[model samples]
Target chain A: MSAALQDLDARIVRATQGGLPRVPEPYAALAATLGVSEAQLLERFAAMLADRRVRRIGVVPNHYALGYTANGMSVWDVNDAQVDALGRQVGALAFVSHCYRRPRRPPDWPYNLFAMVHARSRDEVEARLGEIRALLGAALRAHDVLYSTRILKKTGLRLS
Target chain B: MDELDRVIINRLQGGFPLCTRPFAAAAAELGTDEATLMARIEALLGDGTLTRFGPLFDAERLGGAFTLCALRVPEADFERVAAQVNAHPEVAHNYERAHEFNMWFVLGTRAPADIARVIAAIEAETGLAVFEFPREAEYFIELRLAA
Candidate 1:
């Protein structure tokens, strides 16, 4: 959050609903509305991206209608020693769109690492599970693949 | 303006109306006929451009508590931990980001207390820690691709 971006940035960040303007000079249009130059708007967007404040600017579709009705979030409790190597392997899978780990539990929840796998059918998703299982060897004492029965609003983070 | 795209996206975002003649209603709104609209929608879906066209429910409103949780799983137990967390039906989208706290998943429960209880149960079962990052505010990114 640069000082130059503090005010307008917060406003724009707050307005992270709907889709970004779909126009050639979209930044210019936004700048016009914000009382700034197109360059300024573009710079803000670019800077936000550089700072990892925004992950990406792209379309997020409804996977169900596209035939990926069966989506599962897979979680794991990898040993600290092998967490990195195994996490990289799991994350590299094409179907595993997102993979990461969090602090384990005592005061918190257990099952630290997680990954998401999407497939057209449950069987397809399950097949990947088998692959993951084989890769992890006997280390995997417990694992669960929870399928989504319905979507409860899958939209992007609010920016404004 | 690409009239067709505008029509399609607008219709898609609000969600496909669940009716016998849903396409017909959408066509009417777009100033087109049912057949043409259906054909175009079908094409869009076939091309992998449109992910889905249906209801997007509000989980929190539906009496479910959801929070973003992460775990620092060891490599050896990754698969096992994943299995345990996935056992809960409330878990939604999960991600494996490149960070120390790597395993992230969205947890939802019928009651607010269920969220904590479930996390506690998971901790006891797996003998590890889970970092719950409940959403403080609602944020929706507006970044749809124009193709």
Candidate 2:
């Protein structure tokens, strides 16, 4: 619902999307580049985080490198009337990282709810899926897990 | 990864202070020194133990648009099609999964309209139907994986 970041705000995204510099005074360093006071930059960052323009400002461990080898996109066909409510519960589960309700392309794809689950192995992931299955109960019509075979590309954000 | 590394990964997943000496403040709570904490984070990022370490933007909240799109690229055409699909800068992430609609990627655009444009371009370039999955509602999105 938000509009494009403008002026200095847009510059901040372009500069720091890759990451903030790892330094004792990283914000000060960044502010210098943007020709703004450190206090000004911090204020903007705080506002962005509060508004969810910036989701978070911290570690993003690569699941593969951290031994979380099993990653599955578990999709479910839930009753449309109950999808939003059910999605909230599925997303609250400990193992579900990301969850959403999306339009289903009937005949080809019937899943309207998607949840990403990760674990150390396939068995572990399946067990987690079982938990989701139990949670959805009768509302869960069908489900499938799309296990990623390879990361063809994972380039970072591009400034527009 | 050692115990300390694990602690860092689990502890600093969010709420990393935005102060002048943010690492120092975080280190105090983690029972570690700032130098050690900074070094650990640098090493983690350098070796790909961590994919990213900074502000994670919500493109939608920033007036940008994003969509998860998929296409069923046949075995013979995967590699070639992958290259073609990746050629579009809008495609932020592309992955091959074990499903009929095996090729999935996330498209990020500055505006909502740009998303459809990118999808059309990809469909034209790949000669395949682009199945766009735009989220109707996004639930809680907390991704803190214990390392």
TM-score of each: 0.53, 0.92
Question: Which pairs of residues clash in candidate 2, taking residues 3 or more apart in a chain or in different chains?
Answer: A3-B63
What stretches of model 2 exceed 4 Å from their correct place? A1-5
Cα miss at A138, model 2 (Å)? 1.0
DockQ values of all predictions: 0.06, 0.75
lDDT of model 1, residue A21: 38
Best by TM-score: 2
lDDT of 2 by residue, A1-160 (tens): 2343357788898899889999899999999999999998998899889888899999999988978899999999999888888899999987789999999998999999999998999999999999999988989899999999999998866654
Give the lDDT of residue B140 in candidate 1. Answer: 34
Measured by lDDT, the strongest candidate is 2
Q: Write the per-residue lDDT of candidate 1 for residues B27-120, one digit (tens) a residue.
A: 6877887778766756665666565433232335423566887778787887787778777666765565444555767776667888888889
lDDT of each: 0.61, 0.90
